[model samples]
Structure formats: structure tokens, C-alpha cells
Target: MKVENLYSKSEENPMKALVFDKSGIENLKLKEIENPTLGPHDVLIRVEKSGVNPIDYFVVNYIPVKPMPHIPGAEIAGTVEKVGDHVKGINKGDKVIVYNRIFDGSCDLCLSGREMLCRNGGIMSVITNGGWSEYFAIPDKNVFKIPENMDWDLAASLPVAALTSYHAIKELEVSPNDIVVIFGASGNTGMFAVQLAKKFGAIVIAVSKKNWLKEFGADYVVGYNEVVEKVKEITEGKMANVVINSLGSSVWDKSLEVLGYNGKLALFGTLTGADVKINLSSIYSKHAKIIGTTGGSRRDLIELINLCRDCRVKVWKTYKLEEGAEALRQIMSENRDGRVMLQL
Candidate 1:
């Protein structure tokens, strides 16, 4: 079918996307575009909502795209309108969430059940067109069916941020009475990390700016400058069993300092800068473990979906598709109180 025929041009067919051409953020625009085509292993989804991630802006400005034109978005929720012949376990009219990772499924990491680590993996927004538009196409394996009654905005917001939290917490195997320190607890992933660590029965000690403390669910909250001393005081010189670091270099040393003996520090994002200095003695003498994680596996996504369905966790806010750029801008500004979504 022709791309124009897939969407109604006479009825405000504008997609409302954030476009990053060669010029940069000044070139970012909200406009309509031709609908994307479905591949043999793909599904055509009429996007109901999309999630704005920090990486979206990073990709838009810093990361170089092969061509001048690109759509910057990763997570999305929508209804399936068309399915490729090989697609299975899903059908047209089903509500679904799309994962950004696209793997070959034959790589060493995929064979080891770590598709997110696939050396040849392709991320949706980074390597391909993502969910910034009203309608987009995705490989069948990249889509996870959502409940019919689930809010589209929630579905969109859950994938990227929530999934990252799930992987980090699950990998650490946090348990009751375990002291967990979450750095950057107010950001999208950090919020989910706080809740997920609590759900896993850990005693969460979140660290963020004082303004964001109440909403972040920390047993103790402190400013970035006071994190080490505050965390040390809260733990009574014991330190945390697990430290989840989202701020990267900015808090890397502090996170390491607050960890108890044999503590585990899971690094998920580098919202700060990449380069970091570490005290090898701290790690060596303590016998601490440092782990890194990113996108969730297919199985991890399934578990997260169930967690949301049971209402054990909740999404914070929703925005219309036309507001995608605004949502990204809000996230970039770090002025928002909750997760920002683009509803189609």
C-alpha cells in the first residue's frame, strides 16, 4: 500500500515529529511526514503515545546520523494495523509496546540470553527510525502486546526507563534488608529504579536534589554535594549493599564511597560525562563489584509489563503526540516533575 494511503491526509495527517537534520536542535521541527512501510517481519502501528528519553536529545545533537534527516524517539505504544507474513503470537488491532533493541538473534550474546548486548544489535531510534511520528513500523520481535485496558501513555513510558531499572535491580538480586542507594533518583530511570528496588524488598536510600526527595521515595535524600556524608550518616558508617548510579561521573566517586564491603554498584547511564576517575584501592580492598546494564531482554520486558498491569508501579504523566518535541525539551530542561509521554 502507498504511504499516503495508510494515513488520512485530509484529516490532519501531520505526524508531529522532532526532526534532527544537519543543523542541530535549531533544526528540530514538529511536522507531518509520510507513513512508514512495513517489512516482512514487521508490524505497522498507529502510535497512540511515545516516550521522550535523555538519549533522544543526545542522539539529535551529539551523535552523528548517517544522513541529514532523522526522527528521534525510542519508546512507543500503539495498535497493530498490519502484520508481516512471518509475524506470530500477535495480530492486527492488538495494543503493544515497542522495544528499541533490534538484534540478529544469532550472536553470542543472544545465544547467552543477553540480546541487549549483541555486538551487532541495532537500536531503533539510534540506528533506525523510531516512535516520534503518529505511525511507524517495527519488527515483530520488537513489539510486546499490552493489555487492552492499559493506558497508551503508560505503555509508551514503561519500555525504556522502566526496563533499564528492571535489568539493573534484577541483576543485583536485591533482597529484603539490603541497603540500596539510588543516585539521580528523580530522573525517569532513577524513579523506576527506586520503586523497583523497594518492590524487591530492599531498603532504598535515594540521593537526589533536595527538591526531588519527596517524590523519589528515599529513606534519606540529600543534595548532590552532600551525598557521601548524608549516605554515610544514614547507613551509620555501614554503607549501602547496592548503589545504582545513573549520574555517572558526577556521582561516581560518591556512589563508590557509600557502598558497604562487597557492595555492588550497577552503572546504567552516563547522564554526566563519560570520563571518570576511580580509586582502585576502594574497589580492591572492599572487594566490591561494578556492573553495567542497558536495555532489557525480552523476558525482562514481560516481567515489567506484569508489574505495571498489577498496579505495583505507575507511570507519572502523559502528553499528546503533537507535543513530542515539547516533551523532549522538558526532559532536557530537567524542570519536569514526572515522566513525559507523547500520546497519539
Candidate 2:
């Protein structure tokens, strides 16, 4: 068990990893560890691409799910280098997308075919070793094979952003010709929501800091300050049938403000803050409903990947694995829109 700096590529099977020996990105260091031993139901993946997400930072800095010396990478797409004895339908050289949520296969919820509700399961990188390395092992049940023609980076980007948006869209019950307003529309999940909501036949109003969101198919793009007013104008006083808010606190009130009668407010993130003062009367008066979601189910992820494969969810940006820390920083400092990724 020797710890070494990550300066150059390793020529051995034991790989290099940026490990957080303690909570905080500053504690992250490059170290070498033994190659993973495969379990009967596992597949060894040669990591090709990993998605950078804000939740990764929250987990690394605050969550106690995993002990010190943890690795933080959730979304992944790669080639299968080896499959375990019990693994089937997945094999060497198969391109695949890793489902970042792990469910207890024996749970009643899991058995009911809704494993995303498995009481015992949690996120992939939160405790288990994740994809911020040259290689990692995943349960065969958590892996989905992708077509060879698919781009690895785009496939990696699908697990969280795309799937979560798909789930939120489902939660919002978006219908054809509906008016959908998405807060943080320039964000990773928000951008995906704009695309998916549109494809679902909604006229999407994206609330973003930038106007370029129109490039991604947002029917209308407005800044945070203008969201409520603009939605009113765009819908011609109809407001919105559904409002998607991943941004918390700063925009929560506004999300509620723009909802029409029987509207749905789907919350997926609390970036600004969580707790909010609510007017109970507003809910009853407008007949609006508030719903919340974390990541999405395996079905949502698989469908998202299929969408990516069809050139629906576009690739955003990529950084080398060595610049992993920088990649996280960029997600915090640079454009919050689109999928920011790492290439191994």
C-alpha cells in the first residue's frame, strides 16, 4: 500500500486516483491503489469519461456517507474490460453507461421494480468508490450497455443531468402544448429540462442568466429577475402550467409566483438555500402542487442514454482527469449550464 503522486500515467494495473483523505476538495490527492478484485456479479470498467456535478462537491465537503480517503465521481461511461463469472449480456470492449445509484437488490421496493425507492440504497460515489479513476468496478445490474457509435462523453453526461430532468419532467406531468417555465435553465439539469420539456410538446420558458439558452431549444429565455414577469408575458397572462425549480430560496418564491391554476412546481435542487417561507394560501388559492426529486430511476437513466445516443442530449465540455479538481472549480465558477465532464 504505497501512496504516490499523480504526475504521469501509471504503467501498472493498480490505478491512480484523486482521493479525499478528509472532507474538502483541498484534501484531495493523487495516489495509487491496488486494482479492484471483481465480485461474481461485477464488471471491471476501464473508465473513459466521468460527469462533473455540483452534488459531487456537496458530498465531498459535507456528507459523511463515506470515510476518509474517498473518491468522488458519480456519472460514468466507459468500456467494459472484464466481466465477472455471474455477469451476463455485458462483456469486454462493450461501451456502457454506469447508473450512479445503487439499490439493494433484495429490498421489497427493488423487487417491486422501483429500485430507485429502495430503502437501503444511496448514490454510487457517495460511499462506493466512483469513477474519478482510471478503472472501477460496478455491479452488472447498475451498468447499461450503449451502442458503439455513441460518444463516450455524451453517454457519461446522461446518468444524472439528463435522467434527473427526465424524472422532473415526469413528476411535473408535462403535457403537449403545456407552458413550462424552468428556473436555472442554463444549469446542467435545467438545460436538459429545456430540451426534454420541449420534446414532450411543452413551450419551454427557461430562466437563466444568459440568453444563449435559446440555442438549446428553449422557446423563451429570461433572466432570473425577469422570470415571473416574462412568463406572464410569454403565456399571455396564462402564467405557467409547470415550473421546474432546481435553484432554491432565491427563486423558490418566484417559482410559486408563476404557477397557474393546478400548476406543478417540481424542485430538484437547493443551490441557494433549502428552507423557505411558504404562503399556504397561495397553494390553495392557485391549486398549485409542489414536488421534489433527487436523481432518477434506472429506467430514467437508460432512457436518457438512449436519448443521448440519438443526438438529443448534446455533450457540453470536457477536461482531462488530471485536472479533476480544476473541473470541479470550473463548475462552481464558470457557466453552470450544460454537462461539464472529465476524460481519462
Candidate 3:
């Protein structure tokens, strides 16, 4: 593929990016800045779409970001604009998705294929600049070529939302005999968990207000108030064998209430709230296991891309790069339906 030198050696070029100077939505601005400088092991990408997640909202509104003026976006999808000499197997103009986890290859965690837990590394947007810009550079190993037919929005949602769900579901080891109940079924990660559990042959009970969840492979869709009763009726009082709760404290107790004996619960987010109380007797007596997971591995990402050829995230809305502030605000809106994204 033909490559374009966006950053010239003789003259520098600037690109537009959504950047925040401080921890507030009012501080976000779209300004022209010098293109990200590339290292020998890095590849420059012309971002096409960046997923707007709740974490992005928290980062801009509360979490401290590195280097004062920071770009905040973890899920990224774009075309390769330039590849450094040391970067192999990836060429310019290739469609790709960012891995979103920054890991040092030499770490013991990385060697064990658990890069998300690298002792010396953290998440992409938190430790360094992320993909809210028109042009950004990342290590060649941090990107994977997406299929030519994949939509930009779906590709962008994979790194965080989809990967987190995939990892959590994998940890639970859902099976055909298992009755899986997914809380926050309309949220980004919950939606993927519902589909994945069903894909694994489990009977999926999605807890959400949205009835359309059935279109995404949910065997039963019920409101938050109905989850426990619905699961009981469907399982003939056995309750759920696996309960995936990404809503945090708001549904923590209910999640446990619906679990059957030897049940496993997968946790990956704290959207409503984090602090919660647990009952020791309930856990020990029921033999319940609570598994907390985050991002998936590179191997898991590859598997996800293959398994999701026919699956897609329902995009709620799209905003321009300059409208990123509004996009972040929308992510936290109570009426929001699906994933929000910035389409560049």
C-alpha cells in the first residue's frame, strides 16, 4: 500500500485533536497541534473513529492525565498513515484497531500473556496520549489489522467495551447448561457479554429496559426490577449459573441474589457505584465465585475479531471531532441507548 508522509522532515505539519487542558468538560478544546512524532518502533495512524466510553467521561472530568494537555480516547480505529522502519507486518493505508493496553514486552505478566496486568504499564489514555486526534502514533505491536469489511464504529468499540466483556465472559467459562444473567444489558460491555454468553450456548437473560437486546442474541430481556423473578421462573428456581454485573453497587446485591449454587459472577465495571458490602455466609454456602476482569489479551482480541464477524455494536450516536465534549456528556446520559462515538 502507498504511504503518505504526514509529518515532513523539512517542515512540520499540525493535526486537529480533541484535547483537555484540565479535568473538566469545559476544558476540552479542538486545536491544531504538531502531528505525533513517531519512533522507530511506532506506527502513525489517521484515526477514523474513536469510541466514547464512560471511562472517557471520568478521565476528562476527574482522573488526572499525564502531560497537562492530554488526548482522551481508549477505543480507536483508523487507517495506517505511516509506519516506522522497524515496524513490520503492518504497512501504510492498512485498516486497523488499537490494542488500548500499554505494556512493556519484557514484563513477567506480558510473558505470561497477561499484558493488561503488566507491572510497569497502565491503560492507553491514562499513561499517555490516546486516539482523540486525527493523527496519533502507537507501537506497532499495539495495533492489529482489521478486516476490510469491518465498520469503523464496531472496530473502535472492541478495545475497551468489547474486550473487557470478552475477557470477563471467558473467565466465567459459560456453557450450554449454564443460565447466564447479564446486568446493564444495554450498556457497552453488558451488550457484548449477553451476545457472547449466548454464543457459548448458554441461556442468556439480559437485564435492561431495552427490548431490542433480543436482537443481539439475548434469550430473554427484562428490566432491572424483573431480573431476579424472571431468572427464577426461567430456570425453574435454579437461578442463574453465571451473573455478569458491570453496573457495580447498584446491582451488586441483586446479582448475588439471583445466583445458583456453584455459580460464578463476572465483574468488570463500577458504573453506578463501586463500594458495596458482601455476605460471607452467602458466598461460602452457595460456593459462589466473584471474578473481576478488565481488558483482554492480544490472543483474545484476535479471537474476538474472528467470532464477531457477524456481531456488531449498536451505535447510539456519532459526533464530529470538535463535538467531543458533547459526546462525553452523552455517554453519561440516562436515556442513552448504545455506544457513543466520534467519527472523524
How does each model score on lDDT? Answer: 0.77, 0.80, 0.87
Pick by TM-score: 1 or 3, better one: 3
Q: How high is the lDDT of residue 185 in model 3?
A: 92
RMSD of candidate 1 to true structure, Å: 3.6
Report the lDDT of model 3 for residue 149. 95
TM-score of 2: 0.92
Stretches > 4 Å off in candidate 1: 1-17, 66-68, 210-217, 310-320
Error of 1 at 232 (Å): 2.9
**Residue by residue across 1-344, what tens digits does model 1's lDDT show?**
32212333354445556666763666677776655656567788888777778887777778765334777788888898889888898899999998778788898999888888888876777766567776787778778998888876567767888899999999988989899998888777887888788778788887776455555455666777877787778788988899999878888888888889999999988878768978899898999999988888988999899886633223356666555556666776655666776666
Candidate 2's residue-wise lDDT over 186-217, tens digit each? 77788788888988899989887767778778
Which stretches in model 2 have alpha-carbon errors above 4 Å?
1-12, 311-317, 334-337
Q: Estimate each model's TM-score.
A: 0.88, 0.92, 0.96
The list of candidate 3 runs beyond 4 A from truth reads 1-11
